[model samples]
Target: MAFIERYSRRTRWFHAGIYVAVLVLLATGWWLALGREGRPSPLARVTGLADTTVHLWTGWGLAGLAGVAVTVGVRAAGTFLVESVRFRRGDLRWFVRWPAAVWTGRFASHDGHFDPGQRVANLVLTGCLAVLIGSGVGLAFIDGGIGFVVLRQIHRWATFALTPVVVGHIVIASGILPGYRGVARSMHGGRLRVETAKRVWPGWLHRTQNR
Candidate 1:
């Protein structure tokens, strides 16, 4: 039997919105950046029209969604974002053991939440995005003939960083992760199977189910 539990509507929508916005921003930003200097790439022509205004609007939209998300599930999201860091002694042990546990079907009982790999990615991505947004705002002003060269350079690098991080995330999540099926179900169906609940959620499943 498949457990029909899924993400809350708020969480699902937040994730979906960010996913789309990020892709658009990347595509458009790439066009504007690469299409300069008489570059003749076809996609550049297609996306080159997306200027700082387009980038700013989409980025602000994403930031707005994040603001809403923080308010919607303050405690849960806060824990996942801020307090989820594993600084303790055995925390490191569990991080190393998690994969083996997952391989042998023992991940269900693991107490620590937010897998080590995910935390690392989240930290990197979050930091990169902050820099990207900060410098991007500067870029917009600079494009308008007001911002600094250093800010523009930082924005450029931050934008470039996004590509590799996103590509690696997709590849590793879809290719290497053992619980691909459950991950898909989580996104597709919005909920997870209670049977696989342990592996899917090492910390708390029943609490969410009841909520």
Candidate 2:
């Protein structure tokens, strides 16, 4: 039997907001980046603004939201990161055995608050967001008496650098993970099934028994 606990409602709200903001920023950003110069984007035209302005404002909004989300995610995910990912002999064993476990659906045998794959995903996202945010800030400040041409180049390069990670994140979150429904529910309801907690996190049950 799986144990159940609810994620914080506030956390879920922030997560959902960030997801919406990021997706909007990314879509509008692409139009602004790839659309022909002087030809207003169809999407921007529909939205009744120039695509470039939409992209700029939305990018700023996404950056702010991401900062908030990262602060919260770091705190929420810290425990699993430290305990489950510390260099342990058994961690290597689990890493080596992960493929077979996946094929056989034996996630329980390799125990932790988060599976190794989940840990990897977390790291990827954390690192990518760091880069994205840093680059965004640098890009934003490049044009205010810092030289327009240089700043524009820096902004372009930063955008190029961030694209691959963004694509990879989308693919893994939407296409690859088995816990998509649970993840969706976590965002929607701020709660997960007891079965999920049991399968992925036997430890939490013990710790949260009093609460």
Candidate 3:
């Protein structure tokens, strides 16, 4: 099968960085929020910090990386954002049929850059990241005022909300499910098989061919 570019080198790097940062943040955040009193976090055990220095730094790293991606890959980022939100013909039907397909081991046809489920997931993930970043910034200023205490709660809740989204994304992208096998190689190597593209993203493939 032929191959088509699915992700650029810079985009791949950005995604990898975000994944690592999120994993670190989730681990440290969980320990800080739920660990037994007087017990050190795994990260704290390694770094010898009273608080979660790894979490704080990783949050900043995520924010910074997002900023850099917006600045350096503005066109690519804009294209992704636009495509992810735009509804297309058959998208609604795809959403309507998705649950049964999942249960029955069948799949519906979708002709968009992303199916309806993916579009909704992308929107939710984007919103969650925005909340995380905004509340994280406020948390950084927590020592200065009482308003930031509220922000701390908000940040914690946002992190908790993001956990499931992240887990689901990983599960799907890792191709553990029946229909998604080998899908993750696109992000790893920046290309996908033409057959896979035709099956999963016919609209995008059609557009590329037309161009």
Candidate 4:
């Protein structure tokens, strides 16, 4: 078995930061929403702050992470955006076999950086994050009015919609799924076994070797 670098250490750190902020925000947000607004939830208890305070601060921190991604990691962010949105000839075919592929470890042949499923996931996750941040910022400024009410509801619904997709992403990225074995290392360890690269992202591996 051979190993090759995938994500950079910087990229992995950014990924870690964004997800940590998001998870913290989600936990605190729910705690506050469930009628524990000023009370100390487990997180708040640990931090010695109120639930609402933790939720608000974490949301802003997430927004800050996004800003850094676009500004500091702009090139990487651009590459990811480009690779994720572009479609190729075999993409549709890849989707057809994906369900079975998840367990069978026999992914359909496709050419691209990210798989078709990942492309869809990227768009959905990005959109939801935008909504969550925007609504959260709005909620920060406007208090005790219809605008606040509307933003709260939008934030709630966006959270509702995003949770399942995030879970699926975690399941795959955790390498818990049969076909995604070793994939978690691409992010966590910033490398992949050559065979795992071929099975999961043939085009990306080929492109890397040729480059």
Model 4 whole-model lDDT (C-alpha atoms): 0.88
Error of 3 at 122 (Å): 1.3
Give the per-residue lDDT of model 3 (tens digit) for 97-203: 77665444345776667766777778888888889988887787678566877887887888888899889888878867756665787788877888766656677
- Each candidate's clash count: 5, 0, 0, 0
lDDT of each: 0.64, 0.59, 0.78, 0.88
Candidate 2 has its poorest 10 consecutive residues by lDDT at: 175-184
lDDT of 4 by residue, 17-50 (tens): 9899888987887777677776688898899987
Query: Whose TM-score is higher: candidate 1's or candidate 2's?
Result: 1
Q: Which predicted model would earn the best TM-score?
A: 4
**Per-residue error (Å), model 1, residue 123:** 1.8
Q: Can you write out model 1's per-residue Cα lDDT over 108-172, one digit (the tens) per residue?
A: 23344455566677777777877877776666556444357788677678878778887766765
Off by over 4 Å in 2: 1-3, 33-43, 66-87, 97-104, 108-112, 144-181
Clash count, predicted structure 1: 5
The top-ranked prediction according to lDDT is 4
Q: Could you give candidate 2's per-residue lDDT for residues 115-181 as a string of tens digits?
A: 5666666666556555656666666666556465555555566556556766755654442455332
Look at candidate 1 and tell me the lDDT of residue 172. 50
Name the regions of candidate 3 deviating beyond 4 angstroms.
35-37, 47-51, 103-106
Q: Which of candidates 1 and 2 reaches a greater lDDT?
A: 1
